[model samples]
Target: MAEETADDYLKVIVFQLKEEEYAMEVDYIQSIERMQPITRIPGVESFIVGVMNLRGVITPVIDLRKRFNIESMEYNEATRILVLNKDNSEIGFIVDGANDVMDIPASKIEPTPEVVGGVAEEYLRGVVKLEDRLFTLLHIDKVLNKNNEEKRTVV
Candidate 1:
């Protein structure tokens, strides 16, 4: 008979970038979409891949590869856009591919070490180990705030 803490479990959306696995809490993810045409907007950081029109809304897309300084790869059939909601704004994160949603128990989650997957320490919420796999839980807010250049009027 063990007490259940609020941190006992977390549902995460796992994705791959530069061959490394990463996770973001499912609560923040609005939706997952296939690769879409992106309209490039200049004067922004390289990580900012520009924006795309989703239905009638304009959403900004970010390349996690570029954001984490990881090696870039061509977008193909496996590419995916993870729509995330922060506050009242919605943004898209372009990942190499999204695997699946997983429930990670708190016991398996550990605070981030020195570095995980070359991504900035500040951008990592923590790390977890499950089934011989190391999953880096990302802090999407910090990732998106890295440049904050994407915060603009979307029409």
Candidate 2:
């Protein structure tokens, strides 16, 4: 019934990557899935866990823990794969879990400070503070660019 200004608010999908929470614009997300068998690929970046079949599509999966250089952990019932469509290609990020879809007002987002814990600044767009909780909003372009540019595959 009313116009929604893109700059006035953001709709993000929040997910856990260790103890901290991270978010990405829901526009980029295709689906959230339970952990599935990822067939290993050789010679790609260590963070790129492998590929998995989603229905009929073979999607590459990246382990967020490994990507952020976080300590490795076992994938339990809580583990999830965040499938995202970038440049018409689907890629999945394996995270601790994905739980919420929240709408955050633009005024609540702050530019990332000089120093922040976990995940690199290059991969971050900004930080969102909602009440007492903080969420690191991901820079999907930068996060997905490396994978797209490299297009690495080795036998």
The candidate scoring highest on lDDT is: 2
lDDT of 1 by residue, 1-155 (tens): 79767779899999998768999999999999999999999998788899999888899998988988888888999999999888988899999899989988888889999845478788888899999899899987788786533456879
State each model's C-alpha RMSD to the native.
5.6, 4.9
lDDT string for model 2 (65-97, tens) is 988778999999999999999989999999999
Q: Clashing residue pairs, candidate 2?
A: none
The lDDT values for all models are 0.88, 0.89
TM-score for each candidate, following the candidate numbering: 0.89, 0.89
